[model samples]
Target: MSIFEEEILMLIQCTPRAGAQWPDFDTISEKDSHALAAAFQRASPFPHLVMDHLFPSPMLQAMAKEFDTAAPSDWREYHSGLQRKRGTPPGGHLPPTVQDYFNVVYSGPFVRLLSRITGIDDLIPDPALYGGGMHEVDAGGSFEIHMDFATHPRTRLVNRLALITYFNETWTSEDGGALELWELEPPRCAATVVPHFGRTVIMEQSARAAHGHPQPIREGRQRRSTVAYFYTNGLAARDANDTLATTYVPHAGYSRRQKAELYLRRFAPPMIVKGLKAINKAARTRHTRGRGSKL
Candidate 1:
């Protein structure tokens, strides 16, 4: 590994449980390094964001060109999702394409470090678990605070974690779209980041991980990154005692009127929810069948 790569690897090899410790990547010994990986895997601790100069900068910048996001087809005058704003991807699709980068990241040494850190290597998230691979995100686009898609379509597995890598140059505090991680207690805004390069935020998939940005980008700024999601074996196959479910929690920053509307969407009757979903599926099927029946 290059010196840069080794340095970044050491930074990520430690536990976030110690808060964010920056290791002197050059001086660590072999035994100590082994312990770092061992400690990470044995504890099953919460994933922490890792920052290092090692996150291939030139590579990510070049990769950005491939993200060909389409116009917001789901755009609405009044947004009713995580935030009361818009200009975001409606599903797990990045504009141009980020499939290639994801393939390298997951199987690379990065995964090995993460496997040790999370101590759940057996259940590590694979690119195959994320439908269409990892979704890509960039500037002027923002996601409302919500749990991820919940499940990977093809794998039928409960998504467990999210790994985000921000690749931007000298991200300033003023950058409008800094990623915001809100506090679940008292429901307040907590951690917010400018999405700088070489910085990776890996967090548990839960209500506590409630995060999103709430502002529009400046004329020249861009938030570029690759996101990878992990999943457990299968929600049904997991040990009964190991059951874990992700809950959706909206940002407290929204007004009461907005929240009441959200509560209704979240806790409405199962039948109502099922009916709505069924209607959507029927509409999609009709659209597809209608298009083919023209033959």
Candidate 2:
């Protein structure tokens, strides 16, 4: 990348001290970085920060185009009746431009940037992008509010942070695809982030961080976002059992049908549930043009 390009990356706000750590590519400014760190350290709820224009404009536009044109078969289908989406791993088929962006995030400069922003050290990027990578939620799909799985399935690292870059340029509140952060002590939504184009949401993952986009996507629109989880080796496991499965929770005002679906998904056999989802997906497609909804 050119020096001009590197400078633009650091436009987020970084302090002189952070300069010692990353020396290149503007991370958030020093004042803003400290504020973000303070927020993450607060005792209230799981700390998070929403940043706009996270990456350079050209880079984001390129990534968006890559996702928009990619074939449905390139993505792995994830259907859970209530949540119908697709995720593509960063592997052989990824385009060069998309790979360029991923390469920067996986690089040490960006890792240090995250460490500085969250005040968390020794952060490691998941190479496999397990549960990360390109994610898409189709119209009528919804992911229930719940705590993410604390443990990394393959690396055994404790999941510390979740970085999501929303790419739906024309998305709006009427679109119904917002990442809602919930507070469990009293059961309420603490914040709701619309999947705005070029917007980035950095969420600190903990037992207290309950979130999801339970509202169905509006007709004729899809929620597109890139997800990446950061991990650390120092944090202790959440419990003695060391469970790695996601803990799904129901929010207030949820309908009976929604509650039932959540219960069935939690307890049903994997194969049976998957089979049911496949049948449902097929039926839904047969009636209406699925519009790249094959997951």
Candidate 3:
């Protein structure tokens, strides 16, 4: 196990948000842990369980610093099919310390603790899904509410777990980049966790668990985070091997007019997309020849 995992095993336990106070989980006692877990058993902030502070404070701080310093990659320009980039692995080469930190945290105790808390302890993420690395989501960069890659290709396992660690130095509401969680019953928000420093959130991997960070950042500060997905080997869930949930193109982010356009595009025949691609390519070629460079 990695040292990061050792730190997590030494410091954390599961608890529900209802029974526990916010941002004060470090001091929550065992009694509160049980009560909170119970409260979430029937109903949680979302359809799934939400656990906080999966790693020790010191470890989290260390990881946060490393996460902030890792160079950002050029993944913004793509049909992420949603906001910003989809996901990017280690942006570039890292020093020994940074590499060691990722190795410890990504595959270490963080993953195990996640499994136990969710009662899917046997589950593991195909390293290929995340490449056993951290993912970065920046300011102006946001994601739609959707599930992750269904199964680990090599492992052929259904993804049943996922974890996120936010390292914002001083996240403020104006930052406009807090995670929004929605429940199906009311079909509305149940909780919005501010992306605070040393704050780690874990949740079950289910279609019902819809979540994403809406609105762009207003503050000058940037939003930073890392995520790891876990899976159960040889398991085929109903969603197994399906197109990533993000592909659905969540309509919640759209304005009224945007929503209509999206609906039209979503239900549009596949030939339309093919025709559009051809037209776009031809136009691009003409424009590029006119400018002597591709856009």
Candidate 4:
């Protein structure tokens, strides 16, 4: 057998399959959990954990294969300045393996394990998978640096954490889909996690947990991952005033005009900024109507 196949077999043999489909934290000993918790707390920029070979290779392979075969209609496209990608619609149909992966991770045992590792109790999973699922960014697509929404629109649960699992085999730095974790005060990237196959990243969500994959993918390459967010019933004091919606920030690489607009929104008087937004929305509406009339 090939080396890749051999490695997969070894992983399958070594990883314990308990009641859950994916790797379970219940298998981890108390000592290991303490070490993982330390690593998560000490991670720069935020409390987060990055694990390699997180899932059985065969499972990831199955998910990737199904994702490749999914019809275009299966995805909802995001085309804008801040983000350009595609995602499975919230509560929409998902490939069997991918759906199974979600079910396992969101299970009670898995969630309790997450709480043990992160020290956040009473975590809840979103069954509707709001703003998450299978995500794909094609060539020239990117998501700008931003903080995630603070509250679940439907459930009103305060967003607490995000878990992302990558499925891109043979990925490299040149592929340009690394997840960038940023320092908030100075606004610079603190760490970058490459989206290689079988890698999983779990991060605590707050105003300080700013991150994104802003660089566009290289031609002929597509970046793919599965995402799930966790929540709590109470909002943290630190994030009390964070925007209810996702908030995008200007990056160092952004043009002066873009940066100026960001500053205007941040420091401008509230009434003036609101008036500007109204004017911009009206203009867009008029332009859209004009196109429709021509069509």
Candidate 5:
């Protein structure tokens, strides 16, 4: 193993068993933080860190069981041309084990670890999980490449980071669900990550950070993962942006009119853009109500 992997394994082994189910605050030392921060900042294409077997195995196993046993009605479907997946409802509406997973990750210790590793401070977790939570994509499902929404719809805080953990116990290249990170300047694939169990990816969220699992899952397979976004009042000038919603990359199968609207939204005044979004949201709400389902 590489030195970085060795350090990560040591840190995981040193996690305290007493108290909460998550890693203890004292487990991450100053040296460890510095090392991790250096790795995160030096990542290519954009700042990101991927770690495997970093979390407690028992906890992840429990969370996987929750995903398997979740009722069909518990999922909120995202069914569109760009993506097809099912996500658990926000606002702590999760199974017991899954809720515990969120609780610890959103807690002070975990947030501090995230801040240390990313060199971004004052990170705040979303209690309502607006567009995040446990996500499952069955066979033939895919998500087109896109940058995440810039601003939180409810708190209005600027999104700065995303932490996603995979729960697929067995996955392979044939499964075709690797998460792809793209370069913005030339629009090329920069890196790919397989959604293996106990693997975690923490990415710096910015316009430059375009990612998705565009390839469809193989037959009889499912991709399972949990996502949590962190926010800050402000950050580096490069990461700052005014975009209010998710931005799809141009070549990701967007219609001509949809692409035109995206361009218009970018150049439009903030007030006008927000107004248009509000109208669109209201229409979607009405349509969802008519269909008796939540989107």
Candidate 6:
């Protein structure tokens, strides 16, 4: 068997066998796969799909609980004008519940399923978790519209697709955290997706595929999701300076507040920025704690 197949089997072994059957290759029929392919093939704005009920009900519930209880230390805090979020990637270890979920995501069967949907073959999961993982954005956080980095930092593989699964069971339109897809030549939002529970978004990443949740979330709530990026060794290498990081596109009538924040982030010393973020996070935490338990 190939290395990919062997790794897949190992991931399967990680699944809990509590008398419940998880979705797998054998469970997905050819007809459904073909239909998914055709839908994505002719999708508008860009090739993408919003698949509901992707995981078992029990598993989805477990995922939401896991996100709620995930240790703060596990999250790598990102604080800046462009984005303020928390994320954690697989680093040789993870909670059993999370491990089980990602095991299936990175498995060969799922990889093949994604290939069928996107019509992009030879896709491989990025073990390093570059720009992919469990992401959480609390009240007032947002990611600016930007195109993803084209190539992997370590492997230089061309990044192809992004798969994100939302776990916000109570997200609403008023929350203002929808994933906004944009058009570039004349920037405008083409589509918006409310981060609903158990909804999976498969986006075909390209040099022009700009996206983000530009609006700050409402107070007293958080948006949660998991993301995994797929890659292929298809594109030739370019100069290091050309494609090593995400390129942000500012919207028209960008606020002076945002512009000032961006300037400080761009030119400030790293240590100062880090200290400021810590202070900001502490303030936010205190504010949330003062509100008492909403659950």
The global Cα lDDT (0 to 1) of model 4 is 0.81
* Candidate 3 residue-wise lDDT, 140-238, digit = tens: 766655555565545556767666677777677678777776665545556677777766566666666767775676635567666666677654543
Ten residues in sequence with the least summed lDDT for candidate 1? 1-10
Q: Write the per-residue lDDT of candidate 5 for residues 72-120, one digit (tens) a residue.
A: 7778877655677889776746888888888888989889889889988
Which ranges in model 3 have alpha carbons more than 4 Å from their true place? 1-53, 72-81, 90-102, 105-112, 129-132, 153-155, 234-241, 245-253, 256-295
Cα lDDT, all candidates:
0.51, 0.73, 0.53, 0.81, 0.80, 0.75
In model 5, which runs have C-alpha deviations exceeding 4 angstroms? 1-10, 235-240, 252-295
lDDT measured at residue 229 in model 1 versus the true structure, 0 to 100: 74
List the candidate 1 regions with Cα displacement exceeding 4 Å: 1-46, 68-79, 83-97, 124-141, 234-247, 269-295
Root-mean-square deviation of Cα positions for candidate 5 versus the true structure, in angstroms: 5.5
Worst 10 residues of 4 by lDDT: 1-10
lDDT per residue, candidate 1, 186-218, as tens digits? 565555656666676665564345666666555
What range of 10 consecutive residues in model 5 has the weakest lDDT sum?
A: 1-10
Q: What is the descending lDDT order?
A: 4, 5, 6, 2, 3, 1
Model 4 CA deviation exceeding 4 Å by range: 1-15, 18-21, 237-242, 256-295
RMSD per candidate (Å) reads: 10.0, 7.3, 9.1, 6.5, 5.5, 8.4
Segments of candidate 6 deviating more than 4 angstroms:
1-20, 89-93, 236-242, 260-295
TM-score of 3: 0.66
lDDT of the structure predicted as candidate 6? 0.75
- TM-score, per-candidate, Cα-based: 0.61, 0.80, 0.66, 0.82, 0.81, 0.80
For residues 1-295, write the lDDT of model 2, one tens digit per residue: 1101001112444322342422244545677667656655663456777767557677788888998778766798766634567888544356567667667677887788788878778888986787788888888887878788788877788888899888898778889978887778677776688888888877888888888887899999988888889888854733322447767776676778767777877889878866877897788667557656665
